[model samples]
Target: MTPRAKTPRNSGQRGGHVLRRMRASTVYLLLSIGALVSIAPYLMTLNAAFKPQSTLLSTQAWTPAVPATWSNFTALWSQYDMSGFIVHTAVVAGTITLGQLVFTTFAAYAFARLDFPGREPLFWGFIAMMMVPQIVTLIPLFLIMSHLNLIDTYRALILPYVFGTPYGIFLVRQYFQTIPADLEAAARIDGAGTWTILRRIMIPLSKPILATLATITFVNTWNSLLWPLMATSSERDEVVTVGIAALQGQFASELHILLPAAAVALLPLVAIFLLFQRHIVRSIALTGLK
Candidate 1:
């Protein structure tokens, strides 16, 4: 009967459809604005990196009347030891990422698939620990490092990563749950041990999430300032973030130098994200599904 009434041209239905589309368009516009707002700082950094010191510090619009100079980059590379900082950051990030992934994966597999007394309680304890702020453990961790005589060494940094991260274990455990038990069962039926099953079956299926986690861990460690600052005082042990902050302190007046140094510190992460963006997106989706 309502459809029959619509024989009068269905203007109301058409109007409703038009209104829905308009609402959708408005939502898209709002989202676009939000995205632009989020991206503005990075855009400004990029532009300022290319600009001269006077222009960078000035309150002019993003684009200047005159062409930008490459002297900023040259000065930063020569004076700030940016290349050395990059290598240091890469080493720290790589070591931490590998340590976290391996230990976390094993711990996650044990918690998820293995049977043991008090396993559930231990896993829950780990979950509870995640609720505790990292600040609470900083003093204790420092004391432990101090006692071991590992201060200012790579061991001071790498030892903390060897035990596995609560976040990493939690993330991997959630992913492991999504994996079919049938695969594990088949491997076991074929006399494959737990290690074999995990390495051959579970790990292979979890490439996306693993890649994403590795990327995130690398970025985080590379940008870590507080711990690196506390752990290592010498420029020799400096990571990129601490190096950039140090550079900022040294070149206070030279905005051109400072901005370009900051840009250099950010470039590796930006490049990594750009290269692995698709993998990151897929891994995030998979992680969410878990």
Candidate 2:
């Protein structure tokens, strides 16, 4: 009988490494499939953007042979006044994002670090607000807007965020809690006041969360429709979402005008998301929250 060759002891370790790598590869494959599935609709819209009106309204699904049409974009710009819509959207979204960040940051810092009477209760109250359906406050918010004569203005679009969002404060505060007290203590020993520590130390260190919040706020404002529609009855204050909806409603059957307008409305949020995705991941990792 031929002597069997002995397997080396290290062969077991090598086999274990191979098994681990196979598991990792399987995990990556699953994640890739999920990502592609999530992105499919957006990809379809992108393809639709370049296709002609005839192709867009067709019952068929995605088609690679569809020749690109620059006219769809031109029609989008001229028919819908997309540039104006983009500007309006940008103004409202940018203001809300900046305002929310400033107010929420300060509030979050206070909740996380400062001790005072009623602080815990107030924070809990804010958390409770997050549970309440937003629709419950819509009528009240609208009444306030009407009384303030902020109707048909960016002010109406922006006012809600200035008061601060409960979720925003919660996110920042959670992240702030993870930061060691020693950092703030060091700032205090160096003659930094509350505002100074917040501005110089906390804010800089919280860039990841801040960037994430701004991205979310920007997307929310940019895509907002009902509030913009209710607040601004005219195109003068119409953001992209409202503008796109109005264009589709008016055009009805005109894919040439409607589809491209929809595409235009989508591009800004996508661009911003891409730019800040790293910060978004870091924020989620650091905060352990969405």
Candidate 3:
């Protein structure tokens, strides 16, 4: 038999595979570097959180919390009102999330599905306000809260956020619009009222977006600092972030304690993001599909 010849196609395929692998490797290398850079501060915070106060000054910056102890965390809970602050923050965040879910969903549904007068204009107005900095309205919010005698109260923390955000309305509205109108029209053909259609058809299909909204709202509210710091004075009203800030003066020399308290405030948001990150991305993808 004549010697078999290797075709150009085989070599081209091999070369393409090689090039693809090289590109993938380069992309992975860059991503790995970026991940490390992003996580470095968090790793350092954990190091300091577990390091003994005496060793913190002596140890190098990159030193691990060798023989790591839970004393800092224990002391944080025992010495400070951390537990109460966490519970209070959770309550505030939960209330705000629930409120946003209700109000934002309703508003989004109306804008998306209804034919009310001024609907488009109102929605565009909401979109326009999103460009305005939160700081610009902070004073007005504070005055409203003060006038309502809500300062230093849970109402102050919850009220400002409970009405839903512009971003939330926009996100949910976009997602709502993506839902097929056929399903809604079919429901109406069966004599379903708007409320029935929204309740049964719309909400059930909206779990992903709602979950995304809830995660974002809860994490943002949990990490909220400036407003809480400004609005709340009493330890009873203060959230963990504010409490952690107050520790700066008291635990200035105690790196372990201060960092651990900070870690407590920081880690919840990090964990929430890590857990619900996929939902967030999925929601965005779905919203942008239309």
Give each model a TM-score: 0.89, 0.94, 0.92
Error of 2 at 265 (Å): 1.0
Listed per model in order, the count of residue pairs whose N, CA or C atoms clash below 3 Å is 0, 0, 0
Of the candidates numbered 2 and 3, which has the greater TM-score value?
2
Q: What are the runs in model 1 whose C-alpha is more than 4 Å off?
A: 1-20, 59-61, 64-66
Looking at candidate 3, what is the lDDT of residue 198? 93
Better of 1 and 2 by TM-score: 2
- On residues 150-268, what C-alpha lDDT tens digit does candidate 1 reach at each position? 88888887777656778888888988999989989988999999889988999998887777778878888887877878788887878888888888788878788877877777788
Clashing pairs in 1: none
Give the alpha carbon lDDT tens digit for every residue of 1-290 in model 2.
99998879799899999999999999999999999999888777777778877767674447752578888889877666889989988888888898999999989999999999999999999999899986788889899999999999888988877657999999999999988999999989989999998998899999999999899888988887778888888889888888888887899888777767777788888999999999999988887774
Ranking by TM-score: 2, 3, 1
Estimate the TM-score for candidate 2: 0.94
What lDDT score is found at residue 241 in candidate 1? 85
Cα lDDT tens digits for candidate 3, 1-290: 99998778688889999999999999999999999999898889887888877787899857988878888899888888888888889889889999999999999999999998999999999999899987888899899999988899999998888989999999899899899999999999999999999999999999889989999899889878889988999998888888888888888877777888878887778888888888777877777633
